[model samples]
Target: MPELPEVEAVCRKLRRDALGASIVQLRVERPSVTRPQDPAHLESETPGRRIESIERRGKNILIHLSAGHILHIHLRMTGNLYVIPDVRFRPSLARLWIELDGGRGLIFEDSRVLGKVHLHPAAHLARVLKDVGIEPLSSAFTLDNFTRAAKASSQPSKIFLMDQRRVAGLGNIYAAEALFRARVNPRQSARSISKPKLANLHTAIQDILHHAVSSADAAYAEPGHFAEGESFPCAVYDREGEPCTICGKPIRRIAQGGRSTYFCPRCQR
Candidate 1:
């Protein structure tokens, strides 16, 4: 799944290459990708409207169009957007292809077919994303705000961090990495964590996310890094039995909210 950093990187690429480009055509390879909104409607309405701006809200991509409509796309699990020359060959699993005016095309490819696409009026965007919580990178995610939310929740700290309604754009990978970086146990009760630990966790979340975005910016610039597989730097994520970066003890893997969480037992108490 593409989290905040990966999604933000994609948004930056779109803003650079796809912004201001008028849509010449929209081809929906799979109708199910645009559920609730008819593919016919998207094909008819999306063309002729220029991409005004691109923004990232949580893990969702919002492409504001010339008119009142907004192109909303969620790369749920395996989906990715690529801007290639119109003459370039399309991928086998390409779901939606938006032909641009400058011989370029934006392709949305999803191997698992779990992604979502919607074209809705700007007025309906708030309703569509009403469940998304505050952006952790924004001014709203302060230490006080984090502490209050943590104190109010009884869920484990890792689960609390992954809740979209509480902290948007955080997934299993980053949550585990953030918790490990903060030296906080993933299984610790949210409310039982001390104020100092909560403050550390808050800082760790922002720091890790910022660092990941920076790394992604560099990686996306390199050829084939985004399209091809690239390993992301992580201290304690999916490295079960690996030596802890800080302590020599082996990194432990535990299940929280049915998701695997990796942490150092000696370093993260």
Candidate 2:
């Protein structure tokens, strides 16, 4: 799944290429992408509406359009949006295509078909994303807020970080990396973590997310090129049995909430 940093990067790219362009056409090759809502409505309603701005909330991409409508996209896994010249469009691979006025196109492709698209009035956005929590990269994610949420949760530290209701946009990979950086064991109880370590965890989460976003932005070469997981640096995620970068101890992997978490047993206590 595309997390905060990846989604943010995609938003930036779209803002650069698609902002201010009016939608000339809405093509849904896979109507299942826009479920429950009639595809014909989007096909008709979206055209002629200019894209005002693009934003990212949690793992969703919001394309703010004229007439107060919003195009909400969730790239659950194996989904990517590509902005390319209309001449380069591939109908076979695109699940959805937004034809822009300037001979450009926005393509959403997902081989797994797990991604989703919804068209709704801007007023309904809150209901659409009511379950999402705070943006860790935003100013609202303060140390006090993080500490309060962490101290209140009895879940394990890794699970606490991964909870969308507490901190949005964190998944198994970033959660593991943040805990490893903070020297917090994945199995440690969130409520039992020391205050000082909680502070470390708070800073670590923001720092890692910020760095990941910047890294993704720099690595983004061109349109139609989505970032790969290996483009971002990882401290301990998926490095099980490998030597820890800092302490030279072999990293350990454990299953938490049915997801594998990697951490250095010696460095992260």
Please report the candidate that would top lDDT against the real structure.
Answer: 1
lDDT of 1 by residue, 22-94 (tens): 9999989999999877999999999899999999999999999987999999998788986887625777778
Candidate 2 deviation (Cα RMSD): 1.6
Write one digit per residue (lDDT tens) for candidate 2, span 52-160. 9898889989989999999999998778886887725565678888888977888898988889988999999999899988889899999889988988999999999
Q: Which ten residues in a row have the lowest lDDT in candidate 1?
A: 223-232
> In candidate 2, what residue range of length 10 has the lowest lDDT sum?
221-230
lDDT, model 2, position 235: 84
**lDDT of candidate model 2 versus the reference:** 0.86
Q: Indicate the residue-level lDDT of 111 in model 1.
A: 88
Candidate 2 ranges beyond 4 A from true positions: none
Q: Model 1 scores what on Cα lDDT?
A: 0.87
